[model samples]
Target: MEIAENTALVVVDVQKGFEEAGFWGPRNNPGADDNIASLIDEWQSTGRPVVFVRHDSSKPQSPLRPGYVGNDFKDYVEQRRGKGAGRELLITKTVNSAFLGTPDLAAWLGAQGIAQVVLAGIQTNMCVETTARMGGNLGFDVLVAYDATYTFDLEGPFGWRRTADELARASAVSLHGGGFARVLTTREIVDAAG
Candidate 1:
């Protein structure tokens, strides 16, 4: 659980659009923002690299679409802008994985000699999970801050519904058990960082 000094914190898709519970349905982890803010503070204070991934939804009516205020980073993340020394990066992605984002996440991380990545953001079962899996597959040591990510309830095409908490737990199990990433809580990561 030792966090390397050069480890990168890749925050994925924590945008204002996600605040619209009406659009995303009920969500789990109301304190995800606080957890993410704490992690960012720790990373900035430690001078570790921080990568911010933004999701610019291509869907016309989506709240996260370009030109909308909802597409902007949340106030907490926005306020931390330029605080990561020169180790800060902003990636714009339309997909689920930050690795597939603009400016090339993997290549940039490689250039910085960062092999470890910690993930935290909105949608625990979607963008965050995808980025963690892809990061691990690409040979990076990946850690997922489970309590720093949130997800909404989802319904299957066949009429079954899964709660947000259920989905989050499932994602944790999948990532950890499948060997894609080490899923840990925000407290655990912060303690390790110390």
Candidate 2:
């Protein structure tokens, strides 16, 4: 899909916390971070708006809790944001949906007149999915980078175990079928951005 001039790249929850040992077990989309970083680079180079979302967990034991090393961004993201200055927007959340948290992401986007949003980051079934839903509901054109986000295998009710790949596909279907967003690959988003 061709991106509008008033588009923002939303990078969600790509923190060191998610990288904690076995915190997210057996995730798929191995090169998701590389794809996300590439998107950030492209956004920076093209002078498009870029928003970084971080999950600051309320659970004390969670690695994403404030003051923990895991709460900080991965080195690559940190470096990129450090140099971005006013071009980068950082939104922190303590909940599942970025739009539902303390920050008013939708309002910020509305203020910026961002009609289209490109999403990339971690936990395809969680933060990424929730944010996409909210963005869609708020009437923004939400494009998700399927390969640029990853999630761990999950143990569901009734003793059902879902692999990371299965969860990823589920996320895609939920958003696509629900008309919340259009799921695309990292390369597709990059090529379209070009």
Q: Best TM-score goes to which candidate?
A: 1
lDDT (Cα, tens digit) per residue for candidate 1, span 1-194: 79999999999998999998888899999999999999999999989999999999999989899999999999999999797754999999999999998989999999999999999998999999999999989999999999999999999988999999999999999999999999999999999997
Query: What lDDT would each prediction earn against the true structure?
Result: 0.94, 0.88
Backbone clash pairs for candidate 2 read none
Which candidate achieves the best lDDT against the true structure?
A: 1
TM-score of 2: 0.96
For candidate 2, write residues 139-192 as lDDT tens digits.
999999999999999998999999999999999999999999999988988888
lDDT of 1: 0.94
Would you estimate the TM-scores of all the predictions?
0.98, 0.96
Segments in model 2 whose C-alpha atoms lie over 4 Å from true places: none
**Each candidate structure's count of clashing pairs:** 0, 0
lDDT comparing candidate 2 with the true structure: 0.88
Q: Evaluate residue 91 in candidate 1 and report its C-alpha lDDT on the 0 to 100 scale.
A: 98
